[model samples]
Target: MDTYRTGDEGRAAQETSFRAHIAIAKRYGKPLVIHDRDAHADVLRVLDDEGAPDTVVLHCFSGDADFAAECVRRGHLLSFAGTVTFANAVALRDAARVTPIKQMLVETDAPYLTPMPFRGRPNASYLIPLTVRHLAEATGADLDELCAAISATGDRVFGPW
Candidate 1:
């Protein structure tokens, strides 16, 4: 399952939750999809301390280039949503560029974060192809190659479809 948890105001609670998530993911052997909003540093620190699972993805990655680099260094995958198609989402787009192709994935985040050309509309898995297309163009990856890469990444992280 895709898990999304926010960090609390205090670092202690945040760390606690982060550790708990690590434990839960390990226990279930489930892939983790972390939503790190305005808590990249703390999230990274907690991950460093507790370590990440075999398959961990930073969904809708909003951090800077350095954070993206760090995630890559730690063997964490980065997943981009429709926001990457926005004109104001330059940082997110740039992060996609710097991220290795094998380390990239795509999601529609259905019912939210709809990609360009479909903004304001309800989202669903059907919109994934649009986001993937944009990702391929942004990363200069061939459409077919990116599709295969995305599928492989998804399988590695989420397992067997």
Candidate 2:
């Protein structure tokens, strides 16, 4: 249920589809993965209107600390991508700090948003460790502990591999 902001012309259609997907996710008892891009308030409103699923994941989370806290309070998992490793992502790092290890996940955002040293290059799954390392630093969690927590959270959210 990733509700994208497709501009004014397609807003209605996008929202309608988002609502339908949310409904389907709820009916099937599946986790909802949200990819919000500058439409944070509306996304939360729609989720509230439709009632969020038991398991909600904010994929490549782009919100600030307050928004992260709100999502955390709602029991949503915040998945951080390589963007969080950027030097300019102070707010994102702050959000990560507030998020509990159990509620946090790491991603590569592959083909884009590569971590600092590889910023100009295409991202890949292999670059995930760089993001994880940054997350560990940003959130002040031990590297091994964060990795273990991420693994457990993955199992809880999507079942074992």
Candidate 3:
């Protein structure tokens, strides 16, 4: 299941959608892929209030170091996307630097947020390597090591790598 919503909306809407997601997750027993734009704090509150599933992933995460640390502490997985390759993503790179390898994940958010070397073009899963390379550089891990770790994380979250 996917749950993407802004945390900056009125409290009522956030609560309603959050509850709806929780109910859906409970009924289906599927992982929730959450899209958090600029509402890290509010998103955290919602997760705390409703209690998160074992497979809660923060997709295309753009939060600060403190929020990343808190998410890690709470056992949520952080999935980086093509945005990590952007010049404005210094904070994201820093977050990747400090996050544990086991806790890190990667995605393309495909057809959007294409990584460097193809930023202006339409994206697909085949272009994952671009973002993968950037993630390796940011995290200071070798290509193979980073790839293996990312594969492992994918398996753990989405199942059957």
Candidate 4:
């Protein structure tokens, strides 16, 4: 088989792997939970090309408002993590501001990306409140309401626990 890799070898490998992953998600009718650290643009492009799953989530989303708006426009979900609470995460905070409650999710990303005041410390699901609280504050939504909405969205996307 003839192969033509573009850009760089790593990029080509990622594309190939993403294609396979999309296919599997389609086959199983499952939502895709993505961990996007610094590849928002490429990930968006690939999803656009391959047609995103019925429910696609950008877990630990790390993008600016533009990316968040694009994800909202594309009907993809964004799961906010401890990064949102980082004092230096201006862009991420901006993204959270633009991310509506209905399209929002909250996660701990435990053992890593722990929220400030507890940075570089052990983390667990209990730490979700810190992230969620920050998200609520950033989005200007009521804490209880935001949590409920996130829970509902999670159930909708993952089909319940």
Candidate 5:
């Protein structure tokens, strides 16, 4: 779930909806994939208030090392996207370093946040390797091991394919 700094009324409604979505995910026993843009504190606050789902994925996680550590502590998997491959994402790289391999995942955030060297181009799952390769380097993780761990995380989050 995501929300901007809309008016007070709008923010209230969005938070209500976010809470409902969390409830639904819990009821169905599915992972809640969050699209937190800049509302890290509000997202964490609401989740804490409503109780997060069993499996929560911080989709395209954009938080810094501190927030990443908090999420990891709460057992929420951090799924890095192409943004992590950007040259300016030093904090993101630090976040990845703190996140355990078992708690890390990867994504393309398709049609957006394309990895470097092709940043202006449209993104797709096919470009995931570029992001994955960058992530491996940034986190100082073996490429093969990172890939394997990400695959396992996929199964853990969404069940076997």
Candidate 6:
């Protein structure tokens, strides 16, 4: 489609879109939930140039340890999903280990990225425990403690319900 074009037109529009979103979030004092797949560098660049909101959550973070560290340094939150528990997610696990517990949050990303046992099928909110448990194990943090941290951080990022 139009977004799939390789020329400068689409690229400019994409950049403009990001800038506008960032600007609106900044002006309104709203937290940003970033969905960055393989565009970690581009997303970070935009955030850096446009100035990120006070709180930025990298939803379903897919970067390496170094990128994770950078996000932490920049004071952004990193939310991990079921992919961190995948057999081939060594890099993702590594990132989780190094990310401070206070700066991390667990998510199910329901209807997608189902945890190991439930893979190849649709995921639901009830499956969050599976992801949270994996995150605790990977981070070497006590299960209860990790759960508490995730809960607290999520509340702060999205506001308490």
Candidate 6 C-alpha lDDT tens digits along 1-161: 12234465566777788789889888999988887766778888889898898999998888899999999999889999888879999999999988999999877787899998888798788988988889888888999998888889888878885
The superposed Cα distance between candidate 2 and the true structure at residue 56, in angstroms, equals: 0.5
What Cα-based lDDT does every candidate model obtain? 0.82, 0.89, 0.80, 0.83, 0.90, 0.85
Better of 1 and 5 by TM-score: 5
lDDT of 5 by residue, 1-161 (tens): 45555656677778888899999999999899888878799999999999999999999999999999999999999999899988899999999999999999988888999998899899999999998899889889999999999999999788888
Give all TM-scores, in the order shown: 0.88, 0.95, 0.87, 0.91, 0.94, 0.92
lDDT of 2: 0.89
Best by lDDT: 5
- lDDT tens readout by residue for model 4, 1-161: 01223445577776788878888898899998876656777787788898888888888887899999999988989988888888999998899888889999988877888987788998778888888888888778999999899999989887788
The alpha-carbon lDDT assigned to residue 161 of candidate 4 equals 83
Model 4 poorest ten-residue lDDT run: 1-10
How would the candidate models be sorted by lDDT, starting from the highest? 5, 2, 6, 4, 1, 3
Model 6 residue pairs with clashes:
none
Q: Cα deviation in Å at residue 139, candidate 5? A: 0.7
Q: Write the per-residue lDDT of candidate 2 for residues 1-161, one digit (tens) a residue.
A: 23343657777776788798899889999988887887778888999998998998999999999999999999999999999988899999999999999999988778888998999999999999999999998888999999999999999989997
Ranking by TM-score: 2, 5, 6, 4, 1, 3
Stronger candidate by lDDT (1 vs 6): 6
- Number of clashing pairs per prediction, in order: 0, 0, 0, 0, 0, 0
lDDT of 1: 0.82
Q: Which stretches of candidate 6 lie over 4 Å from their true place?
A: 1-9
The per-residue C-alpha lDDT of model 2 at residue 74 equals 93
Model 1 Cα lDDT, one tens digit per residue, 37-125? 87788787777788787878998777777888889888889988899998898788788888888999888778999988889999898
